[model samples]
Target: MRIELEYNARSIPPADVARSFVPPTPHFGRLLSRNHTLLLGPRGSGKTTLLKMLTARALNSWTHPEAAALTPQVTFNAAFVAADIAWGKQIEAVGSFDFNASRKDAAFVLHTLRAIVHAMREATELAREGRLTPHAKHLAIEITESQEEKLVALVAPNLSVRPALPSLLGLELALEARLDTINSGEDVAPFTVESFPSKISLLISAFNGVTGDSDRRWALLFDELEIAPTRVKTFLLSGIRSFDERIIVKLALAPYMDDAGFERNPISPHPLHDYHTIQLSYPNKDDARNFGEELFARTFERIGVDAPSLDLLFQPPEGGSQLGRRGNQKRQGVPEEFVSLAQKDTSFAQYVTERNLLSPDYRFNENNIAQDIRKVLPIVVARNYYLRRFDGTHAVANRSRKSHGLYAGYPSIVEITEGNPRAILTCVGPMAQDYRQDIERADGFVQVSRSIQTKAIRRVELLLTSLLQVVPLDLGGFDAGKGLLGFVDTIGRAFEDRLLSRPFTTDYVSTFLIDENVSDAVVKAVGMALNAGAIIHVPYPDGGPDTLLRGLRGQRFRLSYALAARYRLLLTLGDRISLSTLLLVMRGVDVGDDQRALF
Candidate 1:
């Protein structure tokens, strides 16, 4: 048997999305409320999936346990208007024909209105066919022919192009025809157009008139608003502050709003006041593991049988011989090399002695080591694996080496995926196939080996690095030879260098804070990196205010653990440093084409 999960929500049909939906904590319930929202996340952070699942079609199709009681709470009729690449192109092209800024904004709003009408039409058809859930059926608009004509007459009068008839299709056709004229770049005269708020109010009134649910609200779910025109984005931002009472505006955009009128900062809409902002960026360590484990278990549950616990499937690599080859010798609990390091390196020996794992004789009792080092076992394994002989001494460490069972197991996989659903699916999909094949050959569940897990993680790293390399970044004036990839690699290798440095100290530099006096081009690169998920913003861990980046200065960011394998860095946050120091080192080295993306 084989199980497959869709990585991209846009490609999934509306019904399928509801069927496979896993409600992201806090965001889903908050989104279901009547408050206006700005859902900010990077690409593939389940933004599209969440927005689409709010529609009537998906709500009716939902069979999840919470659907029974929760679906009815979605009182507003939702319209999923996708401001995707095609819509962006059409809206921007209107300006190519010398359309005024207001005209471009009007066109964007018109298209948005058309999409709402389309959603209503689809819901009405579903209700008429008896395919909608009871709550959704009541939410559907049942417009009579007379009411449709009245709607067109009231709404289409402000349009430069009027509808041929008084029906829904006619209104849509009129909008389409007008869009086509704009797209053609043909000469035309200036004409009257309705304001965005006015048009939206008219539609809501028309919807209420038909549905006979005057008290019910309407949600305009706009996906990918970052791709919309600048004027339109500004208009929408204003709408977030003040909009129609019956209209709920939910805008989806990237975390970095460099293009959305905040050239020096990310989009920072005041949370809880202007609009409720739901961040779907990389979660913290504990949250990531819990959510990722849900996805992991759900993947196995698709096989139609009781699944083993996640730990049973991808067991953590044990220390010593379990992690690496030890010839044909009897397996000891701890590595002999670790014992040797304690004998040779006084610092390492003293560090162990402090923990009581080492005796006064500078020898480790294998039995006592296991019981004593249980808490710091991972650190022990990492230090042993990465520590190397330099200048006839083991004081200084080597640059990271091949995996002695690093970046494996469930916890590591969760960290690598960084709470992104698309990333989780991409990493687990191949392993699930392997699990299926393994079960068919054997009777019981087979543990996915560390090599397999490492391979999956490495594949994701390559794909991400390759994407950053190909996508052009507007560095403005800063020339770093290799564009975004070079910027990311320079930081990544620097972190790796820190991880492997010193007298075996655990407190190494991993995260970085952007210096206040850096060039604008560097700040732009950081913004682009945040937008692309190459680096993630690290909020203060002590429940401080979740503020957006006004500028990169003093803001802390860590490279995505998705690139951790490529640099052999740990799957944890460490001490921070100024980014300027790292850039200074990069500037000192003559980085050329050969030095691009060291992975």
Candidate 2:
């Protein structure tokens, strides 16, 4: 059986969201509460999927240990207010009218009301079809003809076109036509658009009037608020407390500021005060690996196949002793690269001999080589392997035949993608698709060879680094997006020089700290990098505040692990350097009077 995985959750139909759903990390429970919540992470961080899974249609279709335990306690009626890219762009392009802000806001609020009405209709249909749980049956709401007319009159009294029929669907169409007139940029008289509070409070009052269930709870799950127009997005972010206590607002956005970078936009809500924040990406190595492995196992279980763990599925390169059986092989004294480099480079030989890895006679110290050297084998292997090919001038060495082995193994892959669900799946999805016949033949018993995993790692590397060209950014006078790739190359070369330095140092560069007083263009570039996941924030220890792109003055960040293989850097967070110093030292000599400097 060729198991197909749909990585994009938004593309999945609302009714089928549960069918494609993989149980989220433990953060799902926090969102089930009445408090407003924000799901923060870069794109492909499973934000949309988590929000969609909250709706009555998805909840009714979903069956899992976690869902079973949590759903019975869910009294609220959840509605998905999907603001996708196209719709968001349309909102941003609305014409300037007499009350431009008010009209644009009204358009957004009216669309939100339509989604809520649709949700209520869905719940009623589920109840009629006997698909809702006994407890969830009370969530069904029916809007009478009179109630629909009353809502249309209250919320959209100034629309040129009134509902042809007195029904919820007719009201939705009328609002749609009104929005179309606004977007058409025609001459229209100014109309009264209700404030968010007035509209929402009136809608809730109407709901209570119809259902007679005054104690009912409501959750508005807003997906992709990051792409929404600034006025609309900021209003939603800043006004979480203004809504009624019975209604909860859930928003999904990236960690960086809006497109208006570094202008002190009042968008970031206070965590635990305004809303409970749920992070979708794991930065800790151990946490990421555990989550990635379980996700792989559980995902395969859905197809009636017992998938092997990530460790069992990806065999490490033959050079390292870390993967157990490969270490105990009869032919191993140390990796072959060690012996080869010891003969050619006196520095590596002396360094290994001092550590008891090589003998006084310049041969293998077999007794000391097996267990004592296992701890440093990855660094040893990476440094020795790249040192041979690194020509002193360039930072990135030309790829040799065995260069891919440095990034192959389970540890490398998990760290490369930082256990992001979409990234992890991207690495393995290709291999699974390629080996579908083999998997079916063996009833899903399969192991991805090091070569195949290496290909996946390199593919991710190319895709990540290429983001500098693919993502267009406007940074006033700088064109920072174009300079970003060269900037990355300079950083990579600095780390490589450290790794291949004389006498072999383990303290190679891995992370970087941003200087507080850099040019605003540089700050904007770094912010864009963070938003693109090209650089990930390393948090402070012991519950210290991680202000990330907000307070970036002294924040530490590392290049995405996808570039680790490209530059021969290890998967571990090795050491930190000033990003400014690295750039100045690497390319400072090339600065001229006329040309613009990258730093």
Candidate 3:
């Protein structure tokens, strides 16, 4: 049966995205917790969808079994407040809202308070509609009325013209109009900074009053903080520190906001300390696999496909081949496969063995030869040839001539997907579409060809590359964009030199260590790449036991199979690269527009 997939979530409205959302495994529990939280992840990692789900759950409309199960764990009456900061238009419209050197903070805080009040009003309306419990309905109304009364009292005495109603919305409109009049040189008292703290205190008190007890809580969910004006975001974050325990603030932030552009100051509250962080992206391989499976299953079900197993969908096409038994033996340290493959070319095995004898570090002992065999055998068996020299050129390497079946199996598809949701969506949609088109053209049931898989994978690579390009990589002092390009180039060269091995049946390209002293910008950029499914981070084997004890850590960044294939950086199995070489290359290489462009 033919199936269609929908992969791009950004084009969908928030409500629709929430309706089809699947909670990522790692952070579902924390997302339901009452503690203040920062949901950090790259675009398309489902941060906005999660926020919408939370908003739906708060209103009791999200009836999915998973969301229902988590409802009992929540301790708060929650409301979602979107920070739609239209800085340019707002600055032009609000004449009296001066962002002067001395009064910027006041303007920011005022704008933020307006958004919160608006959200509180929305929550009150929800309660009136019976979405909330009877007790909550009464409390919401009471708080809304009281907060409106206090706000009116604060702004009424200074107004040249009185508002018709003592409501918060009326006061805001009147204040804007009054500010405009004052900016035209009319003699009226301006909204002062000293009065903002008191007004904000009253609003907070109203929010706290809704709970009526310290044990009860109210959550203010803030979304799109990454898009908020700098002054506005600074004010909001600083104000969060003073919130009482009864009020929880859950913020949705873009990945590496601080590293990308937000300035970090010692005086501001640290995200790690002030709030719990729920990462939306997969942290490891297992998580990626599980998430990928869940997403694949969901998509299949939506398209009326009975995909009971991800393995079935990803199964290799008939006639596709894997490494031979001898290659498997080489993986386990037996050099028979390597010797046999090389022997096909008249004593090449003996020639290499004899050549190794001349070098002090290249002994021809069984252990050393077996290691070499492990590294070289897969390349030979896959390409069906042996390289005579370690030349740094992919053009000369014995790569597969049959491009169609190279990426033809379910296991191989999973490797290409790298457990990334967007990658899965972008890939599966086109593959399914192609499969359907093929069936229609043949006028009967038809199998998806290897060419289709290759095309879909290429499309995913281009999509990822495009996504990565938009992630701002300049972190003030560190040139992360350049560093990342250099790093990828270094891996490409390593693959050409036979220093890193490529996986035939999996998505991992090769792993190389990152130095401890790598700048945080580069580290975060790597993380962004991982979130984009451009790469994956593999911790050192044995968890680098001593690094854990010593509190020293290093990351092994593995190129995503799709990206490696796109760049022609895929290597043979068992090849390896050193950290020193990578660092040297990264420092020396220059990134040009040609290198950055996906096309």
Candidate 4:
């Protein structure tokens, strides 16, 4: 029952590495025009995650039993086309982004492109591995001093043999040769900056030669392509235009004005076409809340019923010393302020994102301080809050200016996930890497000055509490028979828990990188809610971090979408919220144990 969730690193390799994932479902036709469509989005959006998911799906589709039975021809191969970006200080625009850093990293870009072609070819060949000769079915790259030389080796002799070209210019030559082979005698018109479609027809013909079909679909993934020059953009657009039916080129757009075309009319075609776009939006409160629930649900399913997820983090010894680990707590009553009905479950386990999360098991005995067992959830929350905060602080901390500019924003559930479920995992991921140097400078972060430790701890607290606070909240409503569900309190309680349970405000900015103003704003917002009686605090009878019961009578407008298993109202602070209160109106289940089955 070892429940281990392993993700393909290449698929969702941290967004920092290759942020070019676009979901491939609908966005078809116009958006998903090509199998190789470029995903365009602002920086920090989950492009990488989406890519990883796409790759994972591709990989799974190749091997998964159900997928294999249905879609037999789809191949799954993914690679990271990294941006060897040139840093620019004076740029303030997004649409017309120039990624060409003064520094030269085009070599890495060239290598990445070659790898993309080879990797896709390998995936295509995998469907008939033993049955066919590898080189005969898929094209393999021959690295030479010149890309033209390499192209000549792999391509037909008749294809225009342009040699020794630097960088992506090789791709341009290949396109020309491909068209020249098929349209040799045709009176071809010259490529114009604005008339891009004719160029696409030529490219399409080239692809038709390779796939031997006019409608063969191809997708080209471009990560961090904005660094290329405008002329290059026009040229590449033209090259791809020669093959619109055969390819969809996807690329990342730097989140600045330059990336957006300088005031293109809404109704008109974007100067950059062939890309079907899926824009990432800033997460709203509801979005954040739903995302948490989604994490929980996915994790639970992944954890399954066998291996206890909690044990993954903190397993007790075989001769367990702690008594009643499975049942209700001791005689000491749960706090009166906590929600009451959420007590005594099958286990002390939390399923998060396909992982039954628990603290990493330390020393068997409590005596070993180095191996002290701790709650995995709280620590995960704490670390997330810390790193997100840190991301904020490092982004704008201009120490040389004598003023570390306004720590403008704190993390809004800055969830740093590496497809793993513990602080130990994140300690090794992008979130923790930023601060690793500081920790290394002093053996460990804690060993550093108190100021650093405090700031780090504060961020960890903020993020942790934010995550723990909400679920698919009962956004108030009523059932066919049940009277009301206090949707507001349900949400309010969730939010309150997020704030109170995690670390409050702190002065240290460098640690979690929390914005001073944003941190304080959240605190003030929580306080204002409490002061207004808009958020009421209830006692938990069971002493759990989150009590389950909701109020009896509440705003009844929200019942339509609320699911039964999770929706319950606490009714009143004075009343003992329980299953009995729920049983009165809950129609699906009968009062007695021998209730009739629901259809």
After superposition, candidate 3 runs with Cα above 4 Å error: 1-14, 57-59, 79-111, 130-201, 207-216, 222-242, 254-274, 315-397, 400-405, 438-448, 468-556, 560-562, 568-580, 583-599
Candidate 4 lDDT over 53-79, as tens digits, reads 333223332322222322323222344
lDDT of model 4 at position 393: 16
The C-alpha local distance difference test score for the whole of candidate 1 amounts to 0.68
RMSD of each: 6.0, 5.4, 8.5, 20.0
TM-score head-to-head 1 vs 3, winner: 1
lDDT of 2 by residue, 517-589 (tens): 3555666677677766677777767432225525566777787776777777766676788676656556544
How high a TM-score does candidate 1 get? 0.84
Query: What lDDT does the true structure give each of the candidates?
Result: 0.68, 0.64, 0.52, 0.30
Model 1 misplacement above 4 A = 1-5, 86-103, 134-138, 185-194, 261-269, 302-308, 318-347, 353-356, 360-377, 388-404, 473-482, 541-546, 585-599
Which candidate tops TM-score?
A: 1
Q: Candidate 2, which segments miss by more than 4 Å at Cα? A: 1-4, 73-75, 84-103, 133-161, 184-194, 258-269, 298-306, 320-345, 353-375, 389-402, 439-446, 473-484, 501-503, 542-546, 588-598
TM-scores, each model vs. reference: 0.84, 0.81, 0.66, 0.35
* Full candidate order by lDDT, most accurate first: 1, 2, 3, 4
Backbone clash total for model 2 is 0
> Where does the lowest 10-residue lDDT sum fall in candidate 3?
544-553
Per-residue lDDT value at 551 in model 1: 50
